[model samples]
Target: MTQDYGFALARERGIALGPIGHRIVEENELTRVWEVRLAPGEELGFHIHYHPYYVVSLGGGDNEIETIFGKTIATQEPLGHTVYIDEKRAIHKLTNRSDQTYLSRLIEFKAVRWTYDDDPAQARPEAGEQTPEGYAAAFREILEHTADLPWEPKSLKGLYQKMLWRDEETGASIALIKFDKGVGIPNAHAHASNQFMYCLSGKYRYIPTGTTLVAGSFYCNPVGSVHGPTIADEATIFLEIYDGPHYPVQPPWYTDPKDAT
Candidate 1:
């Protein structure tokens, strides 16, 4: 049996489709990771994007994106560039037009499947992880370059962050955080929703649980599960994501209201 992927309207509109990406490297309950690479003049045939997703550029190059509906775009992708797309278009394709190969890792949110419909409730926050809102009156498409974005200081000393994307209503967000060596969270804490992190570099440790994160480490902390009093053994950088609101109440570690998000 095949998944409906709920493309009734897309089919009715005569859109064609293909696989989501070039190659699947990993998949779990929450996400599917894809490695996308295209040599010069290579094209990815029409494909569907049925879930909310983001792309992390490993290497930058000129590329063109064409929708079956006929609109086309040509853009310069930058190294370390990131973008989040919430639109669930059923027909589109990309072609590498630069001299060098274009490489990226595209991650799709599988926990939430978005199908265009009129639903006001999706714009509202829920108790757990949320699905992408295809029906959102204004779903955002955020683009950022790690090298170009300035890191905002957190209230705590030696802590900083580059906010990539966020939901003002739900407090859900994705960010790149930095912790200087020896800097630490002074107390145990939990979050309002599941927290996910991928270490980009250096080492960080949870004192209470003795759990540690090193380069390439992946971590997940469940909602309301107490754990922390963490320290950076070395200067560290990590990508953090929250499935829903961040905290039941602002933790004392942060004095800046903006840091709470």
Candidate 2:
């Protein structure tokens, strides 16, 4: 008897190609993030995304996507807009329709776990059950704009955030953060989970690494790794994607905004 594979079989027949105007900015056990920039007429060649993912527009504009089935989707996205693709099945290609360069960030989840066995009962539990609560559903956001979300102050000075999603079970969260120019934390800190930062705009320096990150830069601070005292040279905007609750060691100069006199 021949085994039947659904989209997986079809995807095998689709064209396989490298990303267009995109580069692997960061990759780890949980995610692969891509930094993409397409000039007018440039395109991402035919490809299929097997995993759930999110696309965050840095400089939104018009674009056209053509699927293997010949369906075309025309989209006009705005800056800071985010779109989630849930378990995508189609093989597609993207074309930049506008004259200006199109910039965006693509984050793909690497959460699926499978076990091979002849008996169905031996199979592992559903993906959601084995992982931390909400981790399985984190990629389901259809579309959202960070500017429309409310900001919450962190323990650090000049830092504020707008949370995009938080996994209750794992305590992991995705958020948009803003740092006021010339403001910073005075002491280094570490978190319980790995932290990934993608700079959307402005400038800042991570003191320990001595790395000055700017727009389009990506950094991953592994769990237990001590890092900045981040100082903002300009009003900086960035995204923080982390695994597990953000339990950062309190810095010496940290002051809760709520306690301000």
Candidate 3:
């Protein structure tokens, strides 16, 4: 004989279990990334999310999500997909309903300031247009199938990105970047914002850290931190969340061979 976990019981007792099946891959002033895996019939026990966050699905599968209000939503998440949830204090539980295991990367944003601005390059929805119903209504704000988003090429060759979410006021943005195999930029560059990178697939070497990062590895470079000249050993896909806009300053090593005056 076993006790059944029911919705009423969970709400009444406050769902004692908290974030099961999640491993902290990395953390910094700006973000915390968790690598999560749940086998069939496993659940990441009820937990509260106090900050804005995003989830990148590494393995697609069926799942059931129960909100603190006792509402349940079933979804079929796709691999490589990403979703963003606005900051709200909310509790929820997730259960893997598929026969296979479910894998995902959860990135939580901390210390974010939501200052609304009207920058043409920042294409996020207007604050007024966002849900006014609070955290309970934020369930509808989740974006799915992020891999289907269009890729925008940066100034760097052989590198492309898909901007997922951006906040003009805070200058925070989330993006998925792809690097072709053997793509190496010979520059020790730095950015104005803090950046956190999580390797979703493939392998690459971060020259500054002298570390070879593979799938599930993470790296953090704070504001004004100088690093890079990344070399990809294989086609690599990684998730990057930064505090401000990306403007990589060219280093002396990046000088053009044609301008050798």
Compare the candidates by TM-score and give the number of the best one.
Answer: 1
Which of 1 and 3 is ahead in TM-score?
1
Q: Model 1, stretches more than 4 Å misplaced?
A: 1-49, 52-140
Angstrom error of the Cα, residue 24, model 3: value is 22
Q: What's the lDDT for candidate 3?
A: 0.67
Model 1, range 93-150, lDDT digits (tens) per residue?
8998998888877888775666434223223455575645533423434467789999
- lDDT by residue for model 3 (122-241), tens: 234567776333433323353648858887765556777787866655556778888889886567777776577889999999777777878987666656867877799898989987
Question: How high is the CA lDDT of each candidate model?
Answer: 0.76, 0.68, 0.67
Superposed by TM-score, candidate 2 places the C-alpha of residue 28 at a distance from the truth, in angstroms, of: 18
Cα lDDT tens digits for candidate 2, 1-261: 522222343346754445533787656555667878888988888765645677777675899998766789999865656677875345568988988888877877766432223224324457556665554453343456866887777777577888786666666677898889997666677877757778999999977678888998876666687777779999999898766656644345556522111
| C-alpha TM-score for every candidate | 0.52, 0.48, 0.46
lDDT of 2 at 27: 60
Using lDDT, give the best candidate's number: 1
Stronger candidate by TM-score (2 vs 3): 2
